[model samples]
Target: MSALGAVQPAEAAGGTRAERGDRESLFRPLSAEDGEQLPAEIESLCMNCFQNGVTRLLLTRIPFFKEIIVSSFSCDSCCWSNTEIQSAGRVQEQGVRYRLAVTSRQDMDRQVVKTDCATATIPELDFEIPPFTQRGVLTTVEGIIDRAIAGLEQDQPIRRATDEGVAQKIEEFIGRLRQLKEAQSPFTLVIDDPSGNSFVENPRAPQRDDALVVTRYRRSPQQAAALGLQGEELEEPAEPAEDLHNEVLQFNTNCPECNAPAHTNMKLVQIPHFKEVIIMATNCESCGHRTNEVKSGGAIEPQGTRITLRITDPSDMTRDVLKSETCSVEIPELEFELGMGALGGKFTTLEGLLKDVRDLVERNPFTLGDSSAPDRTQKLQEFIGKLQEIIEGQRTAHFVMDDPAGNSYLQNVFAPEQDPEMQVQHYERTFQQNEDLGLNDMKTEGYEEETGSR
Candidate 1:
C-alpha cells in the first residue's frame, strides 16, 4: 500500500518510480493505457449508493512544487464520482499569497492546486471561496469558478421553493459569474494559503510572469494556534530562582524545523542605556537545524521610531543593529524595501542584515526553474550586484529602519555625542498601524462594565 492507504502499482505503465526514501516515495506519471489498472483500486464504500466501489489513488510530483496525492471515487450503481487532491509534502515555514490577473480566456486554463487551508477570492465580484468549504482539488482556473457556480446553484432550488426574492437575486448573480467565463475584462484572482501548500500555475515558467505576484509572510499567533504549532502553550516561566537577567534558562520545546523534541535556551539581557530584551536559541540534533530569535521585553512605545544612517565607510557595516519584528528596512539607493515580518526579530551587525536580505531575494522559489523570466532575472541580478557593491564598500547609500513599535536600534559609534551621519525621528502611529498590532481592539479601560452587563 502507498502512503495514501491505496494499493501501489505493481509496475507503473510508462511511469518510473524513484528509489523510495524514509520520508518520501515518488511516482511519475503513468501511461493512460495501464494507468488506473496497474495502480489497482481499493474497494471503498460509496457514500451515495452505500454499495462497494473502487477508489483510485495516484501519487505524483508537481513540476515546480512538491508531491501530491490525487484520488478519485466512482460508483457504477448511482454513477456518482468525485475527485480530490492532497498535498503529500510538508507545509512551508511561511504562508503564501498569489495574485493573478486573469485577462484572457487562455488564462482560465492555467492549473491550480488549492489545499483545504487555502481561500480563493475574486475581488472584482466580491465573491470568495472560504477554506474547507470544499475538498482540496487539482484543477484549472475555470474549474474553480465552475465549482463556485455549482455551490451557489446547489441551494438555489430549495431557496426558489421557499423564498422567491432570494432565489431571483441568486439567479442574477449566477448570470454574472457565467459572463466571467468570456474573459471580457480582467479580474484579479487571489489565493491565500496560510499553510503555504497551495499553488497557482504560471504558463511562463523559468521566466517571470508579470501577471502573477507571490508573497510569503510569517503566520500570526492566531494562525499558528489554528495550525497547532508549538510554543503557543508555553507560557513565560515564573522568574527563576536565579536572576534571569544574568542567567540563561533552558526549557524543553519542539524544534520548528524537524518537529522533534529539543531544548530552547533563553536569556534576558539589558542593553546599555537602552531597554531589556529576551533572546532565544534552539538547536535540533535530529535535523542539525539551529535558530535564534530576539524579542523586546517592553510594551509597545507611545510613538513609532525611524532611524536613518548614511553609509559611506566600510566601518559602518560593523555597527551593531537590533531589528524588532515590527520593523521595516529600506535602502532607496537599491530601490529595495523589506516589510515587517520578513525576517523575524534579529540582533546582528548592519552588514549581516544586508546579506540576509540578499539571501532572501536570491533564494526565492519563483526566481528559479521555468517560472523565471529573462528580463526579471536580469533585473534581480543587477539589483544583487548593486547590493554586493554596497556591502563591499564600493558604493554609498542611505539605510533606513522604521519600527512602529519603537523598539529597534541602530548603533551609534559616537555614542552620547550622536553621529553626524545619522538621524532619529519619532512619530505617532496611524490608526491602521495600531489596528494591525491589535491595539485598537483592546479594551483596557472599561471591560468590567461590559462583563457586568453580560
Candidate 2:
C-alpha cells in the first residue's frame, strides 16, 4: 500500500473522539474501505493551514491512495495522533508537485515515509529546528540518517567498536580537537563566519598556535565544554617605546658662542660618516664674537671657527671686549675666492659671491624690480645712488670717520650712546617718513657695505 494508504488505519485508530466529531461536523463519514477517500472539506482546511502559518509540507504520491491527513500543532504540544495528516488528490496534472505534510510549529518532526511509492516532493522546509530537539530525538535521528546516507552512498556497512574502544577514540579525538583549537593564532581565531558555511569550535577564545590543531569538524557543546573553550577574545598590542635620548638632549644646552639659546636645542646634528656629532654656535652679547663647537657626546672637539660681524656697523660697536676662553667655530656657507685680496675687505670683492648673486637674480627675475610699483627707473636710480655712497665710503672711510688712520675712529663712529642726540633726531625723521611711505616700502640699501666694515 502507498504511504498515505498505510497511515489510514493508524490515523483512524489514534484520532480522538473530538477530532472525529469535528471531521463529522465538516463532512460525511466514509466506509472503512472508503476511508482512503478524503472529505471535500479537507482541501479547504489544508489551504487554511497554508494561509495561517504552515511553512513546509512533504507530499508523497502513491497510486490509488484515497486519502491523506492534514493537521496543525506546535512542536511542543504535538502528539502522533494530531500530527499526522491525510489528503485525497482532488486535482491531478502532469509533473505537478504537492506537499505531503506541513506543520504549524517549525521544529516539529518532519520525517516522511513513502511506502509503495517511488518518488516524493516536499516544499518550503526553511525553518530552524527547535532548540529542545538539538539534544534529543532529532539529534539521534540526524545521526542515524547521516550514517545511513553515508553507508548507502559508499555501499558499505559502517563498522562499530566496543564501548572502551569508542571511549579511547573519543579521548584521542578530543585531544586532537584541543590541539587544533590551541594551534591557531589569537588573531586568526577572531574571524567570524558571516556566510554560515563554517563553524568555529570556540567563537570567543582564540586558538593557540602551539597547542591546538584547527580542523573542519564542527565542535559539539560537550566537546567545547570538555576543552573549557570559549569564543575569540582579542588582546590589544602595547604601544612602542619612545626615543628618550633625543628628547632629553633637546632641553639642556645653550649656544656655545652666542650664549643665546641654540634654536636646535641639544638634538645632535649628524654629518655623514661622523658619529654622534653636535654643531653648536655661541654668540657673545658683549663682543659679538660667534664661536662654533663640534662635540661628540659631552667632549668638545675643535673643528673650525666662524666670526660673524655681530656689530654690523660702527653703529653697533661698544667698549672693547675679549673672550676669557678660546673656542672653535664653523662658518658653513661662508665662501671666499682666491686672488680677491679682500678688495676693501668686503664680500663684493669675491668673484664667486657676485656670480652667485647674479645667478640668484637671474633665477628669480621677478625680484629684479618691484612689480607692484610703476616707476622702475626711479627705483633703480635711487638704488644706484645708495650703492655709489657705499662704494665711496668703502674707498675713503670719510663718511664714517674724520681721519681713517685714527684708532678712535672705529670706537667713536659706532658708539650708540655717544651719538645719541644725532641718532635720536635722525630716527624721529626716518620713522615719520617711513610711516608716511608705509614701512614695507622703506627699503634699506647698501646693507652689505655698511655691515661688512671692520
Which digits, one per residue and each the tens of the lDDT, describe model 2 over residues 1-454?
1434544544344234454444433322222223443422222122323332222223222111223343333322232112333342221111111121221222112222221111121112111122112111111112323422333334222323335555555455444333323332111111111111111121111111122122222344443333244452333623323663454242333333223443433334332222344444444443244444333433222122222222223323232211101211111222211110111111112122233323322332122332212353344344334334333332211111111111111222334344422111111223432332234364468777877994
Q: What residue runs in model 2 are displaced by over 4 Å at the alpha carbon?
A: 1-364, 367-385, 388-417, 420-422, 426-454
In candidate 1, residue 414 scores what lDDT?
92
Tell me how far the alpha carbon of residue 122 in candidate 2 is from the true structure, in angstroms, after superposition. 83
TM-score for model 1? 0.71
Q: Indicate the residue-level lDDT of 183 in model 2.
A: 31
For every candidate structure, what is the RMSD over all alpha carbons to the true structure, in angstroms? Answer: 7.0, 42.1
Q: What would the TM-scores of all predictions be?
A: 0.71, 0.13
User: CA lDDT of each candidate?
Assistant: 0.79, 0.27
- Candidate 2 scores a C-alpha RMSD against the true structure in Å of 42.1
Model 1 Cα lDDT, one tens digit per residue, 65-93: 66677888899999999888877655677
Best by lDDT: 1
